[model samples]
Target chain A: MSPSPEQAAFPEAFAAALREPRSAIPARLAARPGVDPAVRFAIYRNNMAAGLGRVLADRFPVLRRLLGADFFAALTDAFIRQHPPAGPVLLEYGALFPNFVERFPPSQHLAYLADVARLEWLRHCALLAADAAPIDRAALAAQPPDVMARLRFTLHPSLAILRSPFPIVSIWRANIDPANPAVVPAGLPGENALLVRPGLVAEIHAVPASRADFVERLQAGVALGDATNLVGADLTAALAFLLSAGILTGFFPVSDDAARRSDPA
Target chain B: MAPRRIPSLSTSAVPASRPTPAGLSPPAGVGLRPPHFRAALAEPGAVDFLEVHPENYLCDGGPQHHFLTALRQDLPLSFHGVGLSLGGADRPDRRHLARLRQLVDRYQPFHFSEHLAWSSHGGTYFNDLLPLPYTQANLARMSAHVAETQDCLGRQILIENPSLYLTFAESEMSEAEFLAELSRRSGCRLLLDINNLYVSAINAGWDSWAMLAEFPQDAVAQIHLAGHDHCRDADGGSLLIDTHGMPVADPVWDLFAAIAPRLAGVPVLIEWDQDLPDWPRLVSEASLARQLAGNALAEARHVAIA
Candidate 1:
């Protein structure tokens, strides 16, 4: 339908008032006796910022704790102005927050904040990920031993592997739980986090670097033999951990030719 | 005031064969917040029904889904949408409509509702319920969108009146007229939010009682009561923001007392979305509403006999 002349101007004007800080209320809006158009518009601005800010705080609680409430409010305001939600689902609104923090000028001093944000984002995603039944151990053990080597496994939908140069896991843990005694040490080695939702609750486990490598390769659809070969760590222990955690939901045997054909360039 | 006989409106366009599960009655209820989930589930009879914003539970599986599924089995559910911009220039987003359809099918709520304001525009969704002009073109757009949404969901939905901060110079009709016309053209019902009516009237310098008198009460299927915050504008004029952070104000409760008799048996909801009180306090608010509704029904009956 063709936009009416009035309809054409209303949204454009209202949107400008919302986006531009303290922009004069559009000519289309009327001021009541006591309510100035500008002040009324400010309420909307505050509401938009505060609503999105609350969603950000809920998704990135550690970020909020790391940056005190006032600073976090300012950061969320900036983020809101730059990247308002693209859709109605607030749960999925902060996908780009981690990248935004990475490029954020003021946050440059806190180099590890972006990685921590990424970890939090992963946990948020895992919490809302699709539901699936875990593979039964007996069903998998019944397969032939030779087939196990060529077997390709499907990871549960709520699984994410995050590798960061900073000790993001320790930072997240310490910040999320104040009672935890694990202090984030300076000059510490990086950490790998395995995020999974085996049941209703999502959990992040700090895994060894080798296990991260093995899981990453397995997640990429590599067969068990290839994934184990790629990791120099104890294959049996990693396999046991994966099986016990119920991270592997299903597996299918693959022929050598099929595996070679499916391999990415 | 004498009892007004509301005309029997045709609500049969939407199928009514799928009755709500046994034991669920459309009495007064409260918006189900996360904090009160366990309490609400534990005491299913605490409220007549429960209202929820579908946007909060769009995810596939989680504690939210688990709780809502368990609650729906016992309590009558009402899906109140805060995301669908029925008044936007664009037709309702197809993907959002599909998700809403999925929710409606799964829950089979007693009633479904969305605001008569726009939240998204030009591909950017503002979290707040933004106001719009009540012009002919905008009215046409809103009516068409409402009809499309109803057809998409294969059921009737209610369009609610929004609390306003500013009015448009281009608006040619009052909010009541706009809502009545929208319902007339779209075959949808109205969710008369008395708190919103009071807030908008006070903000826009209109008479709340007059607006209530002109409201299309017969077309109303539900009523919402919530609290607003008192603030000052730039010129030191009073501004009431629909914060929904406090208990229902006395003035709003008075308005409810005035209108409840006319809207007998309509499901009323007490919405305390922010700074939510404890579960017992919230349920107490619903009890107050039930008492007021009961008195209204009795008054209407007395007038009928007289």
Candidate 2:
């Protein structure tokens, strides 16, 4: 038999009920003589909130630790209700969580907390970002002098750089590192992070403020010589660090890249 | 006492299954989580097969994709998806299906399966298997979504029965009847989650054996043996949550023993998602399932001969 016409909107009604704790349960759910329908319906509520909260907690442990379990749970619940996941890949979920915390009033006192969440989020993304083989110095040496000069080098897909007003790297390191938990020096102008997943492991290196722009520009598809000249800082150390860390994927001539982009096909 | 046959919606049109790996025989598998990756890699023969939630490996490339690539070389795979939202009114997401197709093409998994319940509503993915009323409209919608998913993957996908906390009063048929008709209409197979069967039976007040008897037994292709937790719901009434945290409880094992005779060559996965045990402990649990299936199948054969 067909369902009741009213039940046509069942999923929508059910979702609304689950999203709002104060909303009454849908009318049609029934249990046997002994079972309580309200209690049974709550299973969905608890599971939805608890499971999503667990994902947030797992992804942002420092946020959890910093906010403490209770406060983190409250914040997660608020975030979950306001901004539920838009996609099935949960790893892609909560991209806005860092932004959410930044705007959250309770966490306003912890200025670096939002940056830490951003760092953690980047680290999480790095761990799962698409794998790409980086060209070693040998591969670079194979390129001719002209290609090397105007090389529009492709960086590793996992590479990300974040600069924050507060010392996010020191704070993150202090929270995650147990062996050498260094005291986070407060009131610093900022600290920069260079994230790369060279292999399966994701590494977060502290980048100098002066060189962060150069690496970001390179990541944004700027050619090597132009990016270096644009920054016009002591970029030798940053370039050396990128090479040593295997962040350079491959490179082609700038003019060749421009020609390909200009082609309609 | 048999399930009602939908003669109009017979599975005659269903495509034949692809050739499965040799490991499918004597099949007992374990869910390979990240914690056991090293151990699972080191010893490929710990189980005949390995099952994983395809949602976890939907990303382009990672150590997980690498590990699955390596592991697939030695053992067969069962890709159980958790996010398809097959029972939803909306069509299955084409992008998710495309990614799944890529994985299927890349790995050539022996079996691909999703649940009968929906997990997405509107745009938000709830991330939990949510139930539906057992009505013909829901059934038709589910069948269409299942067919779309199977067509997209270019393979027959099994639909698993979800453990429900409460039954819908608006239902027009039994869960078994709903699933039977769904399979008949969609030409899909069934992944009989034995633990879910036991949990739903007790919570919804049914004789577990009677409930099991009502299932479309012939369509059953795979089995899931998992653990659950017993707790009081808000009303302080007994409730069994499908937590998959601990080892398989005795009652669920009893249910498995009863059904194993029907699952001769089917791969049974020991699913422990929460409170994860070490690799050795997981191996031991899988070994127990293998042992139980073996003994049960042997007894069934002996009884038939007698």
Best by lDDT: 1
Number of clashes recorded per candidate:
0, 0
Task: Name model 1 segments beyond 4 Å from true.
Answer: A1-5, A178-185, A230-233, A255-265, B1-26, B234-237, B303-306
What TM-scores do the predictions have? 0.90, 0.91
DockQ for every model, please: 0.66, 0.61
Cα shift from native, residue B108, model 2 (Å): 1.2
Clashing pairs in 1: none
Predict model 2's lDDT versus the native. 0.82
On the 0 to 100 scale, the lDDT of residue B72 in model 2 is 76
- Per-residue lDDT over B1-306 for candidate 1, one digit per residue giving the tens place of the 0 to 100 score: 443333242322121111233312226889999889899998988887788999988998877888999998777788899988999887899899999899888887878999989998888999989899998888998999999999998889999999998888889998999999999999999999999999999899899999999999989999999989998776777789999999899999888888887776678899999988999999889878877766665666677789
- Restricting to chain A, the TM-score for each candidate equals 0.89, 0.87
Local distance difference test, each candidate: 0.84, 0.82
